[model samples]
Target: MILEVAILDVKPDLTEDFESTFKAASKIIASISGYISHDLHRCLETKNRYILLVRWQKLEDHTIGFRQSPEYQEWRSLLHHFYDSFPTVEHYESIILP
Candidate 1:
């Protein structure tokens, strides 16, 4: 499994708007192939910062399957510009844990 993570810093004033947009957009992404699960959360210490975590069966499921789909285009259009800066997205695999 792979975890796709994005750390976003949205404009302070746009936090509520951004969260609403994200809630709608999540349904679109949730239905894609290899998409196992997902969650969106805000930093309690800093409301402007958000962390998005998506679990997938494979990396291609997110990169190729979702991004190339037409639905993704619409999803992007609905929720892309709320960010104050470019969202920093990265992939991860579980490592040593207690």
Candidate 2:
């Protein structure tokens, strides 16, 4: 599985609007192939700051399947405006230990 993470800094006064919009945008992402689940977390130290964590079956499921799909455009349109700056998204794989 792949874990996708993004740190989103919303416009100072738009956190409430951003949250509501995100609730709507969530459906678009969840509909994608290989999507396992996702979560949005708000920062206590910074009200406008948020973290998005998404689980996917594979990397391409997000990079190619979702980003390249028409649903992505809707996702962008719904939530992109709230960002103060474009967020950098990264993916990770779990490490196993003995």
Strongest candidate by lDDT: 2
The C-alpha stretches of model 1 lying farther than 4 A from their native spots are 96-98
Please give, for residues 1-98, the per-residue lDDT of candidate 2 as tens digits: 99999999999999999999899999999999999999999999998999999999999999999999999999999999999999989999999845
lDDT of 1 by residue, 39-71 (tens): 888999998999999999999998999989998
Native-referenced Cα lDDT, model 1: 0.91
Candidate with the greatest TM-score versus the true structure: 2
At residue 14, give the lDDT of candidate 2: 95
TM-score of the candidate numbered 1? 0.91
* RMSD, one per candidate, in order: 1.4, 1.2
